[model samples]
Target: MSGSRPAATATAAAPARPGGGMRPGGPGGPFGGMAGPPQKPLNFGPSAKRLVGRLAPERLGVMLVVVLTVVSVALNAIGPRLLGHGTDLIFQGIIGRQLPEGVTRDQAVENLRADGQNTFADMITGMSVMPGQGIDFGALQSVLLGVLALYVGASLFMWLQAYLLNDIVQRTVFRLRSDVEDKIHRLPLKYFDVNARGDVLSRVTNDIDNVSQSLQQTLSQLLNSLLTVVGVLAMMLWISPLLALIALATIPLSLIITTLVAKRSQQQFVAQWAHTGALNGQIEEAYTGHALVKVFGRQREVEQSFGAKNDELFQASFGAQFVSGLIMPAMFFLGNLNYVAIAVVGGLRVASGTMTLGEVQAFVQYTRQFTQPLTQVASMANVLQSGVASAERVFELLDEPEQVPDSTDPATLDRQPRGRVEFEHVSFSYDPDQPLIEDLSLVAEPGRTVAIVGPTGAGKTTLVNLIMRFYELQGGRITIDGRDIAELSRDELRSNIGMVLQDTWLFGGTIRENLAYGDPTASEAQIRAAAEATYVDRFVHSLPGGYDTVIDEEGDNISAGEKQLLTIARAFLADPAILILDEATSSVDTRTEVLVQHAMAALRSDRTSFVIAHRLSTIRDADLILVMRDGAIVEQGSHTELLERRGAYFDLYNSQFALPAVEE
Candidate 1:
């Protein structure tokens, strides 16, 4: 996704919508909020071929599958031809078979009758045809046994093909999903500001699913169609060249029609997938923000928006299917026309003794067989195009630039962290035109609590973000422990700091697991001690399951204060050299806030702490205070110094802390 916040330019530069955004046919913008690394047109020429080739080296199973497919189709086709030959021989017997050069008509008739009877006898009583009208029942039984053997070969080959097809499709999908997942983890935090979670989720789930379905359905049809067309066409030529030529005449027309349908379907299918993604994103957004929707009484607005997207999906899907579905009936109609032409042309040739009835029968069957594969080829083209669309999306994500490169030249710090930080002439901006911290300079020594107080949008969080190197500064540098932060590995820099965010997020797992996330190696005793220190022990012990209790979907079962305390206990266990508390007590009651404040004070001993707060009481004991306005530091000094100056900090402290209360 784009590693920057969504700008108005993003909305304006987006492609035009189908019917002006009412249909899926509009510009490819279903994943509206989610940005991917920039996208390009879906190219399946050299790149697709190369990708398919790469897969080939690992496709041992596909090789075996192809072999089985060839064998099965060959056996199946030849078996029917042999059966038809036997039927022809029997019919010839019913008419007195024509004589050869040396044989009289009566003698030829006797010979044909004998061969026909021998073949039928073999089919029924198990005997082989002996020269000169002698037949053996034992040989006929052996022929029946041989039929079973042929069928066994076909069944075994079919099973092998099915197993391999499933394996290739599943393994390829697994690899693609793995790559998408890894990219998501590596993208910068700013990507989240532009994209919604639901939109990203749609790509990983719905888009990938479409690719898998296409692979599964199209691959099999591709093999069957190519082989069947070639095999049937060759057989037709062998049986009756004139009739085969007549049947072949229809191919160019059929191809033109198929090609047009595929092209139209491809465009519509792409729109269909785009609309599906947008609809999914809308549904996810509504579900995630159901409380907001209810509070604003905007349920009708949400429904209307969702309905529009859903309608686009329906229209695109219908258009694609309706156009593509034309291939079947058209093919069948053309095939029937060819059949009539072949019958009329070949029948006259047979009357003139140029071609036999058996050859004509075989030619007709071959024509039908050829058209069957062509029909399959046409039907499968739509699925192939859909897979191409999905592959484009998948590759788009893979090619995105990483936010933080894995440092190749990492700087090592001293054995112990001294907790000194310096921001030198640090000027930064989300946009270059609006500087958040223009030529700002600051320093914090070891074991000092620095408080940053500001009005909303005053760049307080931006300051902390820079210290953590979440975004590189535009015109300055930050030094941690006297070393440039950019030189330190991300892991090393992050490991030295702990943060408690305004929103406490917990995964769906046991309380013990969530607490242990801070320090996986911490002992049970240490965990309990941290909990007690943060006053989490009070509520945790009250629960029947205690630490064993499972948290559901961001800890909905626990009150906000309890969740904050749990997070605080978690950070306390980490014991970082620097701690960041961002509005950590904003959701708690007055009593809970006091308890949390006491716990935070104990945890702050001997650590470099940065507290972002609007509450004047929280920062009363801070060693230094920085009051900010509109992305710049307006005032800074010790609490007494700032109060004496009677500036922005002084006004903020009085407004927030001057209220009367019962004496504690």
Candidate 2:
């Protein structure tokens, strides 16, 4: 899943790779590129408890399900007893019919005892067998009907509980999804900067989905199985304690097998999800910069990296499934063994005449009931482990620190103040130890253009980020109209400023709508006017749909210059008090740039503008040009004044616009 995209560093001290650089742990680097290092699985008990706590809001629903399940299990437990009662009736009638018609039940038993048939006499004495009766049809019919009613009632209650459980689980997962979405928005931008975006997305989407599926599939069934075990065990003991012991003997073996298998599979399941997130991250990175990847001829390397991560995921998944899959077969084997033991013991008891055949039959039925639930529990071990693992990843995302809280009481500003910005002794660093911008002070008069010119990694973009409060300052303050910007709410401060970055981002909408995004309340005529001023109208009209041409998500339908023009048009539509243009015209050709420059002139006429540009010609008319190097202002003056000084700015200008050598 991994590919080469250079990560944000503590400081951009070196030139970035021309295209997205090859990611580390590629075929050329060390292994484990997909995910950093394998993480240990979260403790099962704590994670499972935390996951279960998500159902607290559905407490009432869960309680109802529990009650229904108990009712179902109780009713199911009564079935064997009614069946045993009916069996006794048939057995007694068959035995009684062969006895003398005048003989009492006690007389028949005594006769059998005198004939040295004590065990047979004991069996005969246990049932109410009338000597003349062949069968008790009336009692037998009532018992059979009772058994049917009990079984039907049990099934109905089970269905009701399952229906309610589905509702409760879905509600819980919905809330979980909501919480994760809110958390994603609230998280600090640095989290996205430092972490793999694909991994984060996988946790939010894929992990939560897995958790939902597992809960939906296994939660109710597991609950039912446990309750069934308890109810059936009690019934078994009631039928014959000796046979109940035989059924209980295999339970220890089932528990031991489940525990050992679950423990090993827990690590594999954790690995499976971790690899999934890493693979997702890689895929996202590769796709987002696929053009750059191909342009740089790193496709082979990226594919190798992807293949490695994918293989890791496959291994983890197979291992988890294979390990956990062992539990069910082992459980089934033990369950069958328990059945055989119970049947043999029950048969011996029935033959000894200590227990009737009817009792032995019911005991055998209880044996299956008891072991079946245990088998169910064992079978669910893999699901429970995988679900818990996915849930833990979700919890990790939810637990990430959020952005700093906004000021409780925000400062109010005038409807539209003259944009006078001042950076007073400001200092900032992406990392505290590596100071990028230190005590950088500047004053931008109202309705003035302050152009910042610098080499890459001179903190040009970082300075803009600081001004926007996208990041906090390490020292000093920036102010607007003599009021500290920190005192203003982020929304209010940002509303006064409009930014057009070098990169163009267009929505998947018509060109008209994209332009309207700069000011949602703008009228149609105003949107067209801005587009015309920035030359967006030129190419927009050339398209078949003109202003209504829908731009795709990537904006690939339009040329790069056209896309850049549209962004400029959108920024022009905003008409903010302070405007920022960071390499805003870089993508445009000379003719388009000339046209956009005129549009920019009109846009910045009344606003205080901060323009970060490398093309020295564009800033010749700027009121003041600040020359930055290694995050500090090395020179400051009007462009003409700097050129006259023949200092750092003069050297930079010559280096860029130096005339080409004549052909030899």
Candidate 3:
């Protein structure tokens, strides 16, 4: 099968003629039946900005998180310095005990003060008065307790930050999902015509899921990691500017590597998600048409197609993961090198008396802390890229064009319409370069049955789309009861017309509920009356639940003909001024069709009805028969009158009976 196999099969199975059946480029059209080519990766700059903008409503919360993160990191950075102070106090006490007996306490203090170490001596002196005494255990205990208190405070702030950020992320995702749902309803039908159902679903389900997960997991970690890096670097500089410079040397190289790897990996991430969506689309299409695939014995073809898409997704996913995986290990090696350099340099500084042993140990700890955040950032690379890619897909969908705006001063039907409809010189084309319907004019007076007949691809269903305002006409005016349809709201206009399509759609509900869909306020007696008129009450009564029988999704619990009858009954219940029966009896048995014809005749006695059917035998009693060819009405008149005229209608009528072709 070709890539367009689904489209061709749908077209052959149920062709949409002018105003009668499904249109070619309407919902579930050939163009949208299958997934198209993969979309290119979106620009990261714009997508990121838009995502940030979506969180504008929670700016105050975000600001509080940032403040808490900063404070938490600052406390964590100061803890090491405080521990170093305890180490210094112990070293001073040990050395003071070893001081020569002849050296006085004042001399020792003055000597240390001259060496620019007055702060250390003063702290130790306050705890220890005797010069030859051992270390001051009390001072050591005090410094250790202070460090513990600082750590506890830091943990509290971190917890608060996490809590606030989580709320922000969840609320943002909620708003985003709501916007997508609203946008789906507002978008024009043409958007669906060119987009696959599964692909659109992927954006709503998988893509949004990715975005939400990434934000929830990555946002807090990202903020904490960044603040930790900055705080560690600042403390390192405060201890010794020279050692801080040495630690900073590895940063430029690590960043260059991270940037190169991230750039390559981002593209793969985008491709991976796109292929995932395509695979989902294929799965949805295949499963929805499983019976058809088996009937045609094309299971192998379907399997091969699925395998191809699956493989593509796997390759893209692997490439993205492998490239991003390189970042952590590479940064780890760089971090180790920085640690070694800082240890050696700090040892040399301690020996030269430029730094204390405690200070050297603290500086080394800070260097380790600095590299840890970089590793964390590297670990988050995959999540961040995936999230941005998903956000791009969602935003693209949200940006789709909606239906044409309603008129500012719209017209309304002054009273209940008498079921008169007119098409005045209407012109339209799905593709502007290929004109379909041109300068067509027609009128259906109240209580008229107008039958439209045409061959395949003759724009039969397109007329119904135009009449329902599913597609705007290029040039023309369609009026109901002398008022232009364009001037009336679509909801009001559609509510006044009832349609029974070739494909019967019944939701998963009780039979009564399905019947009441056309008129929710319909009484139970009225519902039974409508069902009885269309012969639906017979099968419905035979079921165990009768009118309360449950129908599964797709209404597969009932036979196709029974489903069709139910839809016809629904139309009867609606009782609109104008009624459309597009191949309504196609699935029913001959006997059932005859019964339905009788019911329809009575229903049409007081309404304008348009019947589209391929079976010439069924529409012989139509008051007006329109023979359409190449989008234009070639002949139209009463069934007998058209037969006598022997025009386009005669040829179509005779051809159906397998009679000799008659010249128009």
Q: TM per model? A: 0.84, 0.91, 0.88
lDDT of 1 by residue, 288-404 (tens): 667767988988877887777778779988987888788888888888898899989977765554665556676777777888888777767667777776666656667777677
What is the lDDT, from 0 to 100, of the residue 533 in candidate 3?
94
Q: List all candidate RMSDs to the true structure.
A: 7.9, 5.4, 6.6
Pick out the ten consecutive residues of candidate 3 with the lowest summed lDDT: 1-10
lDDT of 2 by residue, 489-592 (tens): 88898888889988788999999999999999999999989988988877876899988888999898999889888888888899889999989999999988
lDDT of each: 0.72, 0.83, 0.83
lDDT of 2 at 454: 77
Clashing pairs in 3: 17-460, 17-461, 18-459, 18-460, 18-461, 18-462, 18-463, 19-460, 19-464
Query: Would you list the rank order by TM-score, best first?
Result: 2, 3, 1
lDDT for predicted candidate 3 compared with the true structure = 0.83
**Model 3 TM-score?**
0.88
- Candidate 2 achieves a global lDDT of 0.83
